[model samples]
Target: MKRVAIFLSVLMLVSASLSYQFYGLPYLQKVDDFTLTDHNGKKVKLSDFRDKIVLVFFGYTFCPDVCPATMLRIKETLENLGDYKKYVKVLFISVDPERDTPEKLKEYVNFYDKDGTIIGLTGTPEEIKKVARSFRAFYEKVPVKDNPEVGYLMDHTAYIYLLDNRGLLKLIYSPRKDNPKRIAEDIIQMIKLLKMEK
Candidate 1:
């Protein structure tokens, strides 16, 4: 019993340490550019979001769990950003553009935040692939027998990438590391550090 208790304590400590690494450190990178159609059918270039912090996620509208959950975390994170909201934008790019029409993406995103703070995007499969490669995001489609529900399911990386004001990569959040409160706190801290730098 004592040995089991000791092991549990050690496991807890390790878990805490990993959590701190994901939310506490500012992991930076230089992401490649992408061009895709926005929810409004406007052609949006990565350069368009320049000079502001951008949180980018790649997922499809039909996603069962991770996508919506991540978006919720993003909304909460923005709420926690306070005045820094003006300096950040959430970009959701769809990998399954074959099914995720521009209008569909728009409605889905608006369902989460109607203020136009989060932008939903879709483009050709090639375009999405380019963006995915740039961000090192993984996505795979598994075909299933004909069903009225989703005929196929996508296994994708459930993550959010935080970019600096200059559109440079700053951090990454996996599903295991994301929560409304944690994401909010992380974004707030990053914005504060960014402000201090500028």
Candidate 2:
């Protein structure tokens, strides 16, 4: 069945990702310390979360399916971790900055995290572009030919990027795999590994 095939594929990716000592994780490619205006209207830098593990995702408020679903899985991951969620930070970056202003971003992100568990960020298109490029993520706007008033939609990368407490990039998760539980488990293991190293 189609679902079985997808599960198997996700299982394979998860298996590979668990081998943290191997190729599933990123090395020392440091992310740039970019400034962002967060949903709370606060100027935040990526470095602000240095002591916590950061999970970053790129999408827009107008996303029809993937964004919300991915966010839900992330929330579930946090719930699964229970009290340990305090050690993690989730950041949603708007790929469509034109319509996702700071005010709009606050409402959108709050819908997913009423307790302010996730912070949404939007900046000038140029600033967002620089940030996206820094993370090696890509996004583009596709215009709607049928209705001008309907506006446009964005095509973007859907990987959830994980950065360790020390600010080093660790793993990138695929939402389409529908295996966030495994991803969360991997993250917890990584957290333990990091703790032991300290």
Candidate 3:
């Protein structure tokens, strides 16, 4: 009886540790609601997407490589979702608010998202900073040397944030490590988990 009790206690501890480390429940950060202008020149709030599994990415339209590649990966993730895609929402938030006007954002995101489902967001510098701070996302402006037309570039974090239907951040994925298929599977699993909670 003593051995059985000890074994059960160990098992319970291990199970909880695994759940906390892998599942990101009870301790995951809850994203605060933020309002920003979408590509369509409309004010959009994070709470507006409460019913969706939102994927938030921070990047600029002028990015030479990372932004475009990550956007394509997100597009592929949506494609992989198929019928489940409707339950997901992608928000491409531009860190370069000085250059990424609403019109430019619309053109940029439209190039990849033909269906117009992906929403590109930009806001005033202060507003962008507030939102970035909420996600702990970093971005800095670096001036280009001897570049007359190209101007400066933004150095920003590349992590993709996954928020549950209730706007609670549940996962963070690296474009360099996790592929679209893996992300899609995670989203589907998250959907199942949320449904079970209900």
Candidate 4:
């Protein structure tokens, strides 16, 4: 019996290690509400999305590669979600508040999201800083030396944060590492768990 117990313990450890390697860690902390301007030029609070499984991504529309790729992956994730997509909301928070106006954000997100599920958000520099700090998301502006016309670029964290329907952050995924199918699966799983809890 002791040998069997030891074998089960080893199995559990291996399973957990594999899960973490593939899916990353789950964070179950409650996220505080913050208000930011959406693409529609309206003040929107984070708590407004309490009924949705929110996927928060901090990036600028002018980002040459990472931002667009991540948004496309998020589009693919919503596609994978199928009918459950209605229960999800994607918030694209701009780290570059100077250039990404409400009008520009509306155009940028609409190009990627035809169904209008992805909402682009931008605010004053201080407001952006506060929201970024709350999520532990980092962003910095680097002047473009080679191109004078390009002006500058933003260096920012690329993690996609997942919050449950109750507004508790649950998981963080890397666009370069995690696939859309896996992300969709995790969202569905969280939705199921929330339903079960009720």
Candidate 5:
């Protein structure tokens, strides 16, 4: 009976420990850096957000559907962050640099920064292409539509990438696979993991 009790205790301990185990996180790979113009027309580097958890998505102001939905979720996630909001940053990179001027980007990105922490970034066409390529995010313009009020649309990869405070690519949330609450939960977990590491 004593031996059986010890084995049961060990099993319970192992099972409890498993609850804290997070298996999918990889040691984040280093990302190439770039300097781009922010919504404020200020030069910003990808490194600027170091020491903070950063969320990134490549989108354009003219986007009809995906961009708005993604931005809304990001806004909701930020709202759900509570006290951790200070340590989080969101970077919206405009894929259509030609039409997405710094001013336009500022308006678009700020609209989603419910807490006023998000940054909108844009640059020359070449610069945009370089940043997009580094992120492995695809974007391209389709032919213009007949409606004069609306212009051509861009088909882009709908990926929300999360980079850790140490500038490591940490997690990715996709619209189909994740909702805002889930995204916020992952971020909270990452923040806790980082705290544990420190």
Candidate 6:
């Protein structure tokens, strides 16, 4: 009984610490460094974006609805940030790197932002799998009867990650929200806090 009680105590403490870490009390597990090719074929390291607030989303280009809608919301949220954009970056990493070649990803990202506020990235299946696992993201392919050549559908986590300038995780948001402006406000607040920290 005493051992069980102690274990529970430790579990609670660990949970609280993790929450604070991701929530900015300085206790979250930082993502391990990784190198993946961006939509432009430029090599990008997760650590390269250091000192910039990054919003990371995992999805594939061919997602029937969720991916596109979430990306649009992300774009809108960044736009809503206004002058503070200098400190923030939006990253869309593809889970289906097998199909999402660098060139194709580049075209998709460009369609959303001409100036390139949003960047798309893809890599080998193994590399992408490693990164996705680190982020605790899950993605699976769903077969379609008509599209046998190209996997018809992909089911993946639809949450967006809000990371501080130092790459510490902060907030998770759903794709379908009543007011995206609220999300923008949260991001703005995080940016302000990060700026103050620096």
Which has the greatest TM-score? Answer: 4
How many clashes in each candidate?
1, 0, 0, 0, 0, 2
Tell me which residue pairs clash in candidate 2.
none
Distance from true position, residue 133, model 3, in Å?
A: 0.3
Q: Ten residues in a row with the worst lDDT in model 2?
A: 20-29
lDDT of 3: 0.84
Highest lDDT scorer: 4
TM-scores, all candidates, are: 0.82, 0.83, 0.85, 0.86, 0.83, 0.81
lDDT of each: 0.78, 0.79, 0.84, 0.85, 0.78, 0.75
* Model 5: per-residue Cα lDDT at residue 180: 74
Predicted candidate 3 versus true structure: per-residue lDDT over 81-103, tens digit per residue: 98788788999999999999999
Candidate 5, residue 133: how far the Cα is off, in Å: 1.1
1-198, model 4: which lDDT tens digit per residue? 645644554454355446543263565455779999999999999999888889999999889999988988998999999888988999999999999999999999999898778999999999999999988999999999999999999999999999876666768997566689889987777676556233
Q: For model 5, state the Cα shift of residue 37 in Å.
A: 0.5
**Least lDDT summed over 10 consecutive residues: which range in candidate 5?**
20-29
Error of 6 at 133 (Å): 0.5
- Name model 3 segments beyond 4 Å from true: 1-27, 196-198
**Any idea what lDDT model 2 has?**
0.79
lDDT of 3 at 133: 99
List runs of model 2 lying over 4 Å from the truth. 1-28, 196-198
Tens-digit per-residue lDDT, 1-89, candidate 1:
64564455445435544645436334545677778999999999887887677888988999888887888888888777777677778
- Output candidate 4 Cα RMSD: 7.1
